[model samples]
Target chain A: MVLSLTLLFVLSSGADGRVMHIKSLFASPLSEPRVGAQRTINLSRGTKVSVVTTQDPWVRIRFAAGTGWVLNAVLSDSPPGKTSSLLDSGADVSLNARKRVSGFTSAAAARGLREGADDFSGSKFRPDFESVRNMEGGYVNPDDGYAYILNGRTR
Target chain B: MKQHVAAAFFVLTALLPVAGAQSGAPALSRARAHQGVISTEEDHGDLTAEIRFGRALAARILGQYKLSADDKTGGYVSRVGAGLVAMSGRPEIRFHFGVIESNEINAYACPGGYVFITKGALSLMSGEAQLAGVISHEIAHINRKHVVRALKIHGGGGSFASGIAAMIGGTSDSSRVILGSLMDRGMDLLFKDGLSIADEFDSDADAQENMVAAGYSPAEYRRYLQKISDAGPGKTTSILSKTHPPLAGRIERLKQREGRLGENARN
Candidate 1:
């Protein structure tokens, strides 16, 4: 147990110093805070650079031979050991699916508990077998199909 | 009556060349002969005469445009434009440069030393050499007398369509009718006409010659052209396309003439 716990702590610390990759070029014609003409930089197709600092929409990065600031919108977290193409394509899909499933389960449990309870006494007690089964099997919810369809993860 | 007097004065100026040959006015005779050809008829002339008239006319038209003659901006423009002009064989003609207030990206020259460039044109230029490229082209127009000769050929009517109408002598009313038809066509000619392509090529050639003469790299013209081209088509057709040469063809011509122009840094 101690060995396992130590390994987990090391792993958690390792994840803290993650490096962010710059995905876009942002330049303003003037050095002013606003009213400057902004343009995108597209140096290469798969170029990678790390962020040194960020302030809202602007981020400064160190690129080959120099450092410059780019827009924050042009960047995304670089996934571990994966090429940018795969990370970009799969990251949003998996994250959205997981969030939808967890949200649905919690919502259904709360609705079932509320509807089955008659008073404070009943509410404090465990739900009946039918109520528990109905909630778990998706019978307590008439909108499960609709939710799945809307979430886009049903297929 | 005033117009008649002006015409008589012009004629006397033309005849003075022949009448003064036996007198001690040989230099005046030569000056009159040069002026006669420029005044009596309009055609591109030898280098020295074109340079003289280009400097003179540029000054007059630039004054008419009400451009500021303040030494600050005017001095900067003349310094840059003259450096480029000096490369075109160091002609004796003075160079006059002016900045216009309009937001349009345009630069053009009138006869005799006038070059007017808009602030909008300056905003678009990325560097000093790009400005040189544009000014050199306008100087070529003065040297070629493209506008004045076209005006004389077309009877002082505004544009190409009017020139065509005047050539046929359809009617005084016909000139008005031609002017009406030109409202839309004129925009096309002014904005996308092919003559500009030829002018652009000539200017590019002249600019290359001037750049080499000034001891700057001629390749900068190519680089500057690429930047303007990359800025994408302007809001209207590029003044370059409308009043100058096709970019791709001019670039290719510059490339061909690259070796003959004096050597300088490539970048």
Candidate 2:
């Protein structure tokens, strides 16, 4: 009885510490919250960190390497590389099957959820989805983005 | 008696976190909430619905304004936007950036992750940072789900029919009518009523944060807004003036944020 109670206590208290993951393609942890501060290491996306505190746009976090500051926008509650596949596969399954399986998809048909916005296509003007797709297709490589940042081209 | 003690201890320990979180977690809670990551099955359905809605909205916008044929310009804008997206905390929805042929100094963001800047808006930007500021603001709107919330476009499974039902608090049988009505209203929201001033200000603040995170100057956003404000009653500025709050107010807020952050930096 004591052991079971202790396990329950541990599980319940665990929610107190929230883990945030790096959302940016690559984030360099700074020694301070300010921009132009010294950076010791680059953390890749989805790297988990325990947040210590926040100063609005910046968050101080503790990771395997050490404690450092990263921008708040560079963190998310969800793990990276999980959402897209979930959405895609979920879309492929028929609405009826999904309804039988889960409440999430049970009302999908009633709600008009589909893989893409193709169902909403009866606008007076022909929707230029082709162009939107073309735009989506042309992703800027992450390496190019890093190069852009390194060069301070935007600065 | 010992078992009773253990049970009581377990309950107290479990409740402690809840009490502590209630006392000291507003900021963290707000951040987690704003991230809006799809964590549950319901969120998954809502997000899928949001994407579909956004795609249709993008199509409508594209129909109204032709995409700029200049690949180089489009590519440059895409690259800058990509950097902002990296820092946006919304990796689930792949953002697509494009340049439209309109000469108006305005940018539009659809619910999903579609962003477009007008050629005139592009011309107004002095450099890539300024462009980042602009794109970041639009990205902020999408990231924050401003349109989605305003339209009440989440829940009720996933179709426009059900979304419409949710919005109107009634049922609709015709999918076509439902979708068309929703699209028209969304268009009106973008082109007519505009998002609430609070939403605009929130995006401005978020834009600054995103800019700084992406290694760009938030001041550039201030400068761009100032430039547009100074340009005055021209064709290029007309749409923006209607769709956004006064530039002076936005600039003042940005300056205040800068001052606060600067103080933090000093401390």
Candidate 3:
């Protein structure tokens, strides 16, 4: 019982945060957050990593993409654009069987999320830029954010 | 014609905010003095309107570059952004963070709390502090409402979409078209002319302060600026290329204060 409790507390306390999918790069979860400490490896959008521990606001994830420690604010509990994928001609957009990821077929479509949530074609423009706006609003509370930052940016 | 010119002058001056207003961060004392006769109770109304206007502009930027298809990347940015905002002077505003897929090498801030960074810009970054620096600058812009000030036409002090239209209502037909097109003017700032050089410098100073406040190294911010400066001219149409050329002075300013940022640089 004690072992299980310890494991549960460990998992919950240093809870895992997944790498968010977007078009930016992340610092190597540095050996330390400093000038010489900058790691060459970085995590790009779509790679999933796990957290080993957290020191305050900094989340410590041991991963190969070079990001060893990152701010807790950098990780997302959920993936953002899961439905967005590159589909080949004649293949259904919904089909997940294909492993290959490609760029958008249409420039207009790729400009934003669909006009409506269900419209995956992504070609039409809606007056309401919901997807864009939502991405901006996805902020962690300051108190929570500071706690994450307290975690050192290190390996 | 002179009457028209006089009216135009009035409108232009209204648009060209004074020291406090032009900076977008009017001193509290100045604001209070300006509003000496007015009730503080009405301040809330102005804030509400400001937030509403910011939201509309953010939506328009979304129209420019949709969110990246990779959700985690968006999430990652938000996390970094949230950390910065948490440490900022204005933590109450719910700031939004997004990475546009365009290779433009740019970042933009909309009033209210909307910020967008491009993949090209991210590709150029070396560390989290650099990212925070770039973002802190944008957040400063947002916090200061610089772009919002630029977009706004005073006098009537109403909806951005309609304020300019209202200001130039009695003018010639061509001017009316120009007056109505706020989006065109806003785009010009993002894609062409960029903010007034003064605004950029002010934001740079503010960004460094915010980065330090958030426990990130301002030197990283300086390093990022150096990298961008070293890259020189990029795509002919690149936003950074066109607007940020004045960065030599900016670089000098950062270098002058590099020692202040120090090793830890944070409080």
Candidate 4:
């Protein structure tokens, strides 16, 4: 059938030892496939590795460091450009770096919503920072997320 | 000959996952599956802006509805949501999932990564797939940056020097006023205006890909929507019905999408 031929063509297009690069915005943890597996390493964005195998949502990859599993979503066939320094800098950038990054905040300042708008008062809805913080504090650890997937996966 | 090659390429792209599964190697990034509709790129606006704006909006939503104290249910949803988030193509941002104590069968996704599902909606889900389906839908909205793009809340410094204090030198009283007004408009969008129909359809399409890639049943998502539709237009379903397109229409579009992808293409 035509579909059969197309499938064959597609499969043949890709070869063994296919290379992929990390496409996640931040560093991604390469860990064992199983639930509660220890992280093998944290591969930064754009790190290239060879594909070893895959499970749904997890791909086993062979990097220079070692072979381990990574989320399939984090792998891209094409290498990504340099990650955005502004977004990736986090809270640790030096004072000079902050000056370079001040454009973003300056724009917000122009709009009257400066960087620290916490003292924002006179709102009809009493902003409940405490409750929001509590909710955010209960982040689901990646290990727990993997366990949930393992337990819930029917296939 | 050219037409034939094009057709083959289309089929190959569609069936890449099937080949990947058989070869024990990922065929292509699942992110590509969504690239047609929603680009995997996340350059909507400033990262700090999205988070701060989302947090502020979340606080207001919490102001309206108290969070459920059921740790078991909350933890379960959080775990499932987190797993999906890991593969959501927007892993850079931390996501928070909360269950609010509301009888209304609705869910809300804030601009950044805050997602809330009402207890009433929780009761309607029959199984984990159904829950995943719903959560995936909300995740789609967040990943797509629907609210953020619509609100136009952009540009903020990174988490440098306690972002607020760093801006104290530039603070104007008008900034507080502008932020408050922005919140008011945001509330209206959540409560009355609702996102565009195009956005809803896009989210549903993205959710289908998310569910299929995550090894959950995409059909179950349609089924969940059916369940909501069957519940009829009552108080519990009022807000959902008001905000979203008719469930019947959404289901039909999903069917069309799945048909295009072909059943075998889904995991």
**TM-score list, all predictions:** 0.41, 0.75, 0.56, 0.65
Error of 3 at B165 (Å): 20
Best by lDDT: 2
lDDT of 4 by residue, A94-132 (tens): 233234245435654555444434533435667765556
Candidate 1 structure, TM-score to reference = 0.41
Off by over 4 Å in 2: A1-17, A81-118, A121-126, A141-143, A151-155, B1-36, B158-173, B263-267
Report the error of model 2 at residue B194, Å: 1.0
RMSD of each predicted structure: 34.3, 12.7, 15.6, 13.8
- Against the true structure, candidate 2 has what lDDT? 0.69
The backbone clash count of each candidate, in order, is 14, 6, 27, 2
TM-score of chain B of each: 0.59, 0.81, 0.73, 0.79
**Residue B103 Cα positional deviation in candidate 4, in Å, after optimal superposition:** 0.7
Instruction: Write one digit per residue (lDDT tens) for candidate 4, span B116-135.
Output: 99999999999887888888
Instruction: Evaluate every candidate with DockQ and list the scores.
Output: 0.00, 0.24, 0.09, 0.18
Residues A1-155 of candidate 3 have per-residue lDDT tens digits of: 99999889877645554433211123345575332345546665335676666553344675655345554334443332211111212223222212111122232235332222211111222234455435533545445555565563651
| lDDT of residue B145 for candidate 3 | 61
Tens-digit per-residue lDDT, B139-174, candidate 2: 888888877766667644434233333433222334
What is the Å distance of residue B28 in model 1 from its true position? 29
Sorting all predicted structures by lDDT, with the top scorer first, yields 2, 4, 3, 1
